[model samples]
Target chain A: MSLKMRLGLVFSGALFLVAVAAWIYQLKEGLILTNMQNSYSWGLYISGLAFFVGNAAGGLVLTSSIYLFGVKKLKPLAKLGALTAFANVTAAMLIVLPDIGKPIRLYNMLLHPNWMSPLVWDVIVLNLYAAAAAIYLYILMLPELTGRLGWLAIRVDDPHAFSERWAKRIAPVALLFAIGIHVVTAWIFSTQGARDWWFSPVMAPDFVSVAIAVGTTVVLLAAALAYGTGEKYQEAYRALGLIIFMATCVHLFLMANDLVIHSWYGNAETHRIMDIAWGDFGPAHLFEVAAPLLGAWLLMRPQILGSLPRLLASSALLIAGVFVHRFLIMPAAYNNIPMTMTPFGLPESHWSLPIASGRFLPGMGTFLDQYAYFPSLVEVAILIGIMAYAVFLVLLAIARLPILARENQ
Target chain B: MKMGMVIDLEKCIGCRSCMVACKQHNAQPPQTWWNRVFTPGSHRHLTPPALGVEFFLPVHCQHCENAPCEKVCPVGATYHAEDGAVLIDYERCIGCRYCMSACPYGVRQFNWEDPEKAHARSEYQEKYHYGYPEDHRHEGRLVYSPLRPKGIVEKCTFCAQYRDKGELPACVRGCPGKARFVGDLDDPDSDVSRLIKSRNAFTLLPEKGTKPTVFYLPPKAKEV
Candidate 1:
């Protein structure tokens, strides 16, 4: 047992414990566990699900490398990307479970679905994407699985012939499945209709670009952690860092174009939300504009923040920024039921519906307000559990399989 | 047996009586309702006293001849029956909320939790579909009718459950102004059928061609 592996196990185990405890408490309490209600039908859980699903685009990003760009040197990380996509998607599904009124009956969506609803389309597309991504990941893993099993025998001078032959056949076919997952997921968000921001013509490219940015961030962070255990995976880390930089550039370009159009022709309702980019949500504003700018800035001088700790901090910033982008983008396109007045010109009544009805004020106790959806302690715990669960699985696979064997080296 | 509706827009005061009546009769929770009043295209920017609100469309499911909700339901939970009334089999509903999202008019409502929270005991017992089966009327909780469950999709059934029992729909019966007309669209002499024939009527989003059976009277000019 390597020291790096031992430490990974401990950290993951602690997170897993906290997450399980929180999730159990929430399950017992229903959706009241989160700061959610009828008006805000979707809040933290849905947003988190969207981001996690977006992260599955990492496999598509990797396919672009070995298949599109012909970067054969980056081949080893392809499976890592697939693993990350699968883990994130699985985690996303778990988050959705407790978010609904009755998690068990989520399938009734298929039974009673209105064909026109974009929310229904999201479910269909997400399920298809998940299936495709899983198949893609498994196809890539087949050879590796066979290789590890053979190694277990080879070290003792015994080997199986059929497993090696089967492994050789499946590798090429997995590539197609990889591209399908991200493209389909992109279509789900982009094609929702007239959501100006999400329904933009540049959605497909934007989806791929952001996924690559987040995906590489995940890989780079993984490699950085590997370094503390003296695994010396700096070359791999740098390779992922470069991908992150390029993807960040592509993502920023799409955002710039989208923002320009919005600035020019955005409706009154849209301007109210987009103003947050420059308004009092300073940390969020900084995360969206400045953090990425600083990320791009750091790339120019990698020696400054390229070390393990700083790299982690920057990766955290990138994650936070992308998340904020999802938060704003999802709620950004909503239509607020405007306040009405009496015929006599007096204010008639305040309105209540799903989107804008929540009463929120900005302060330390902001979470109690209607619009203030700070993930409850249970929500945070569940999220932490999911992250830890993914990490635990990855570490266990590495420990058990010959994932980073000297044969590859 | 194609039962349907024709609403006289001129008489619709937007008092929301029909909506309130639907909620009360159906015993729907305060927030969950099958019918809604949308006053779209407010002529707020129009010159004063020029019919400031363009129209009030009291909308529910059209019980379309070519229903989009029926086609998209993966489990075959919602379907157009032999009588042409769209029906939902609640026993299989997963409540994915697809129908609610898909209906352009947004008529579908989720039973987000148990229906009891929204229904008083007397109301839930009296008005719930299937009426707690033949034997379970006194039980504290009734297994939801085959037409509704926590996870399954639900929408306006044209009050098919009541129509089957020779009762006027809760909404249609409870309407105070008699502004709403419901009858067999197949029978030319049915009051709603006659109403549609005399009025310049249209369904919302007719361009989508769902061919909704419900019709609305285009308000005609009246002497001041």
Candidate 2:
């Protein structure tokens, strides 16, 4: 293995170990270790899940589009995008495992699933997408898989013909599943009538638009990183950068529309959530807007978009911006505590006790008090570990899988 | 028949007897309460208010007819029971806490730690007692246990155990002020139904459209 690969494995392994330790501790103690309170139930983990799921969309769209549209120039990059999609969707699904309060009882989701719940729909769609992505990746790699392995050589007479025919047939289905995964996830939040921020009509479309932007950017960055600034890969880099720029523009437009509509005639709850976003969490909002704008500007310059290093940096910024956007969306709405009757007096005589020290304790008077949530140390560690694991999975695939096709083909 | 409660905000002294009774009956973990009493006017706890709204408002699971929490539960862990009360099936819960987020009233609480450990360290340990023992079956059905295991969502069950025995909810029976009335909301002659008709009762967050069964009678000026 290369030194870079060796170092990456070691780093990711260490992170995975730490994550495991944190999860074990959480399992022993329960979710009390996290900063999530009754007011803000879903926190960093759900946001991470949403972000990663969006990241998976780029690969699916790119690879499926390549097949369906017969984009000859982008044909060589199809496997890379498909593999990235497969890895990311798997990572997205895995990250939520630790966030579940009863990880062991997760099977109940399938066994006694409530069709009315958007989460159940999300689970089904996500799993179907993952399966489709995997099959798509495997079908794309059938030639290598069938030829290299002796046992597999007997199963297929012409691997190339088999892969070509199968790939053509599966592209449309994969595309549909990819779009469905993101829509279902967006619906999970939007369906909640109580959450004014999430109940917007623009949620699903915005989710798809942003997902395409981030996903394509990730693929572009990965391609640039692996293949370097060679003349052969320049066309792919420029094409992806153009796609990212357009998608980011759409995402920004939708964001503006949502903000305007929300502020124009929304309820008091909506105004309160918007206030929190623009006030206390202003930096995150600004970063979400500014980073993509910067990336779009860079993409307008042909020279910068064509160059590998510049394209990689621009893509990185866009991806980070979308992530911040996802992070901001998840918790901002929950900060508006629901209407409750204020206590006649403090619940306890003393406020010095550790339990009573919470900022929005029960008897703190008003039900509409500002609620704050920041992921605790253990949550941060687990998040870091999940990211590292995704990196490790990508590295593992690149090293073992026939992801990079021969240039002549 | 739909079971529900009618709380007289006029008579509530904010003593939190309902909260204490719930804790004592359910033996919930530290930092978790199925019921809570809130003072309305000020943001700071115990601050004397100029608004003259001195009455305390005790809030718990409203047991809504159109429950948001029930609709959002992925595993059907939370469901509307036969008597219109929302209950959690602990064994089926995946602990995603979607219900907690969906609940506009924020009545649900997740067991962040083991109940045994929380009970041991709790200041109210002396008052804690299990309403039903673990693995103790009653009449061929597993008795509802007050102690919840770690990592599951829990909330008030409307005292289903007491309801099954034809007794009132612990909170209603324990109220020093005798301010709470529980009965069949569908029954015309029931106290809750009669109070809702005669007293100009109001439900919390009517805009949410949860259709909460709990009704509140506005406090009189003299009471404040």
Give all TM-scores, in the order shown.
Answer: 0.75, 0.91
TM-score per candidate for chain A alone: 0.76, 0.90
Question: Which candidate has the top score in DockQ?
Answer: 2
Q: Model 1 residue A365 lDDT?
A: 28
Write the residue-wise lDDT of candidate 1 on A1-409 in tens digits.
Answer: 7887889889998998887787666655444456643333455666676577666666666656666676666566666766676677677666666565455665667555665544555566566555655655554554455553654332312222443343234334444444444455555456543233455777667766777787767755654554331334445555666777787888888888877776678655346446544453546656776676566445434463356677777878787778886666544433322111122121332322221111122242211112434567777777777778778876876677544533542
Give the per-residue lDDT of model 2 (tens digit) for A1-409: 6888889988997997899899999888888788776667788888988988998986676765587666567777787787778777877887788789889988888788898998888888888888988888788777886444434432667888988888888888888889988898899888777778888889999989888888887777777667776788777676776777788899999999988888888665556777887877888899999998798668656788667778778777877888789889766667666653333353422111011111123344223334567788998898888878777877777776677766522
Compared to the true structure, candidate 1 yields what TM-score?
Answer: 0.75
What's the distance in Å from true for residue A30, model 1?
3.9
The local lDDT score (0 to 100) that residue A366 gets in candidate 1 is 12
Clash count per candidate: 16, 6
Model 2 regions lying over 4 Å from their true place: A150-154, A340-369, B44-48, B120-144
Would you list the C-alpha lDDT of every candidate in the order shown? 0.58, 0.77
DockQ of the candidate models in sequence: 0.15, 0.51
